[model samples]
Target: MEYDVVVLGAGPTGENVADRTRAAGLSTAVVEGELVGGECSYWACMPSKALLRPVIAGSDARRVPGLRQAVGGPLGTEAVLAHRDEMTSHWKDDGQVSWLDGIGARLYRGQGRLHGPRRVVVEGPEGEHHVLTARHAVAVCTGSRAALPDLPGLNGARAWTSREATSAHAAPRRLVVVGGGVVGTEMATAWQGLGSQVTLLVRGQGLLPRMEPFVGEHIAKSLTEAGATVRTGVGVAAVNRPDPGGPVTVVLDGGELIEADELLFATGRAPRTDDIGLDTVGLQPGSWLSVDDSCRVDGHDWLYGVGDVNRRALLTHQGKYQARIAGAAIVARARHCPLLETDRWGAHAATADHDAVPQVVFTDPEAAAVGLSLAQARAAGHRVRAVDKDLAAIAGASLFVDDYRGRARMVVDLDRQIVLGVTFVGPGVSELLHSATIAVAGEVPIDRLWHAVPSYPTISEVWLRLLEGYRDGADGGDGTDDGADGGDGTDGDTDGTDGRGGRGQGG
Candidate 1:
C-alpha cells in the first residue's frame, strides 16, 4: 500500500483531511486537477468580499472625510477585479500545489477514480497512470459546480455562471441575473457596486427565500436603494445573444422582455460526484457512501465523502468542518481513541445535516441565519415563538447608521427554552453570527444566556432586545412562566423586574 489514506480533490476540505491525517502520523495522498483552495478561495467568497469591503470602506470614507455623496461612487471596477485575480494568483493552481507539498502529503495532479475498495486509479495531467492502494481509507471531497437550469436559449446564448462573474476581467454595461439565491444576490451587489446596470429576476416572491423573510426583505430594500432593479416571481422565458455587445433579451413568462448586455445564472450548485468510481465500491449518487456520527461511509467502513460532493450543504465552512472531523475520525479509528463528537462536528453523520447549518449572504445589509425558520420549526413539530425587531430601533443600529433601517429576528423553542434560530440583516453585521450559532448549537437555556452578555452599542444588543420583547409578549399582561413563550429567553432572558440599566454604552 502506498499510503494509509487517499483523498480526492485537493480543495480546501480535501487539503484539511490530508493535513489532519498526516498529523495523526498516517501516510496520506491528495489528488487534484484544479486549484486546491477551490471555488470559495478563488472565485466566490474571497473576491466577492473583496468587492464589498471597498464599498464599505468607501461608504465610511465618503460619509466622514469627503462630503456631498451618500457613499455612492465608482469603485474602479477594473482595478478591483485585477486585485481579485492577483489574489487568486491569476487563477494559477501553483499556490495550492506549494501548500500541499509543504504539508508532507503526497500530491497527484490527475483525474482519480475508485477502482475498488481501498483502490484508486489516477490518470495524471500528462497522461500518466498510477494506482494507489490505501491501507486504511479513501475519501471523496470533489466539491461542486454551478447547477444550470433548463431555460430556453440558456445554453445557446452567451451566459455567465458564478465562475465567470467572479473572475471576469471585463465589466459589462448591463447585467441580468437569473436566480435570487445567495450567490445571485451577492454577485448582483458586487456588480452593481462596480457600475454594472443590474437587474435581478427571481423565481420567488423575494430573494433569499431560504433565510428568514426579514433577511430577504432587508436585502431587497438595500439592493433596490442602491439602484438595482429586482423582479420577482419571474423566470426567464428565452435568451438571445446575437451580436457583440448586443442586448441579451430574456422574454418573461408574463409577456415581458428584459434586455441586458450579459446574462448570469446564479442558480444553486450540484455535487460533482459523477464517474468517480462509486459503483465499484457499492456506492450510488445520492447514496454515495452515507455515514454515521463518526462519518463512516456505510457498507465500506473505510471510505469517506466530504465537501459539496456529498450533496450536503455547499458552504466552504461546512466542507472544512466535515474534513476536520473526518480527519479526526481517521485518527480515532487508528489509535482506537474514543470518537470526539459534537452537534456541529459528528453531526455530519446523517440526514440531519440541515439541523443548524448557518447560511450567510454577504451583501450590504448582509443576511445570516442558522437552524430552521419559523415555518420549518413548526412543521418539524416544535412549538415555536418568534420575535422580530426593526433594527432601526436597536441601539446597535442607531449607533451604526444614525438613520438606521435594518431588520432582525430570533426564534425560540418553547419546550427547550433555547434559540432554535436567529437572523441579522444590516451593514457590518457579519461578525454577529457566532453568538447565535453558539446559542443554537449549545441549546443554551434562556436565563444562562443572559449571563452571556453582549457588549453594549453593538448589533448583538439586539439579542437582549429580542429576548426582552419575547418575555414582555409572553407575559400576556401578567408575568407568568408556563413555558408559554418557548423563546430563547421568553422566560428568563430579561429579569422580570423592569431594571434596564448596567449594560453601560460603548461604540
Candidate 2:
C-alpha cells in the first residue's frame, strides 16, 4: 500500500493529522493495534469526565441551600457506568473507523512499525504481513503510557493504571491512589465521589506541584473535607498481593502498611516510542522525539512527531493543535510551496505550545490554568505582577453556591502590560479558561482588556476585580506588586459572610 501520509497511531492527534492531510486531497493511511479513537476516547478523557460530571454536579447541588437536601443520597453508580459505556461506544471503534472511511483515509488494523525512511510494515492479526510506503510524510502520534516505579511485587499485584481506573465496571470500596499530579488527584476525586474510600499518597510536599502553591493547598483542603485521606510527603516502599483478585497491602517508606481493594499508580507518563521502530530511523527507542515548531522531527523533514511522543504539551487539546500545524506543514511541503510563514501564530507554526497551553482539572472547585504561573514567570526572568481575587466576592459565585470557596489570579508582564498567564481555582471556572487562553495567546494588552468589560454580577466579574486591582496598584506607584489579599479593596465582609441576595438569578 502507498499513501501521501502514513500516521503511526489512531489516537486523536493521528486522527486529526490524517483528517487534514485527506482534506488537502492527499491519500492518508492510519494504523492502530487498538481501538481507533485511542486512549483519550476510551480510557483517559471521555470515560473519566463522564464519571466526574455527576460527582461534580452533586457537589455543586450540595452547596446550594434549596437543593442541598435533595442530593443527600448516593450516586446512581450503575447508570453512570452505563453512560460511560455509551460515551466510549462500549469500547468499540467502528464509528471512528467509519469516520475515517468517510474522510477517504484508509484504516489498517495491525501493529505498525517503520521499516526504514518512508517505509512501514504492519503485522496483521492473522500473521499476515503488509508493507506501507509514505510518499511524503509519516507522523508518529503513538502518544504515551503510564510510567510505574519498580516496586517489589507491583507487577504481580494487578494494580490499575489510568486505563483500569477509568474503565473499571465497578468501583472498589477501598482505593489507594499513588502520585499527586493531575491523574492522581483527578482519579482520587472521581473514585472518592463514586463511594470509594480513597487514600491519595503523594511523594511530594503537595499536589499539583507545578501549578500555583495555593492550588494544591485548596485541593488538599477540599479532598480532606470530602472524606478522602490525602497523605503527602510519603513514598510507597513495596506492594504485596498474593492473589491478583485479592486485596493489596502497600508498605510506605516508614514501615506503615495500608490495605486496599485496589491500587492505582498515576506516577507519570512515558513516550510510546519503545517498540515503534525508531531504531530504523536512527532515533533512540523509548526516548521522546524532539520536533521543530512545525512538529517535524529534528533532522528529518519527512518524519513528524505529534502529541506526547514529541514531549510538547502532553494534554489532548495541545496534541490536536500540533497535529493541525504538522498536517498543514506536511501538505504545504508536498505541494512544493514555501512553508507558510513559520513565525509565531503563522499558518504552519505551533506557537501556543510554548506559552499558552491550557489545562483544567475537574476536581471539586475545579482548577484551570493557562500559560505561565507566578513561579514560572519569575524563573523565566520576567518582571511580572500577580493579582488575585476571591471568587466568592463575585456576585454570580454567591448565587451559584452558598459559600463558594475559590480564587482567581492573573499574572501580568510588567514590560508588555499583557497577561502572561491566568489561574482560576473555583467552581464553574473551567468554562472561563478560554478567555484567558485567548488573551495570553493573542498578547492582548491590559488597557485593551479593560475596554472588553465583563458583564455585571457574573463570575466573569472577577476579571474586572483583577484588572481593577492591577490598575489600583499601578496608580499607587507600586509597580509589579502581588495583590494577594483578595484585591477587592472594600474590606467589609470580604469573607463571604454576607447573604447571597444581591447576585444574579442563575450561575
lDDT of 2 by residue, 55-89 (tens): 99999999898899999999999999999888787
Q: Each prediction's TM-score against the native?
A: 0.88, 0.94
lDDT of 2: 0.85
CA deviation > 4 Å runs, candidate 2: 475-507
**Every candidate's lDDT:** 0.72, 0.85
Cα deviation at 461, candidate 1, in Å, is 1.3
**Total backbone collisions for each predicted model:** 3, 0
Model 1 C-alpha lDDT per residue in residues 232-333, reported as the tens digit of each score: 888777777777456788888877888888889887776677768887877775343456554567676788888666655667677777777778888777
* TM-score for candidate 1, residues paired by index: 0.88
**Candidate 1 minimal-lDDT segment of 10 residues:** 491-500
Scored by TM-score, the top model is 2
> Model 2, residue 247: what's the lDDT?
97
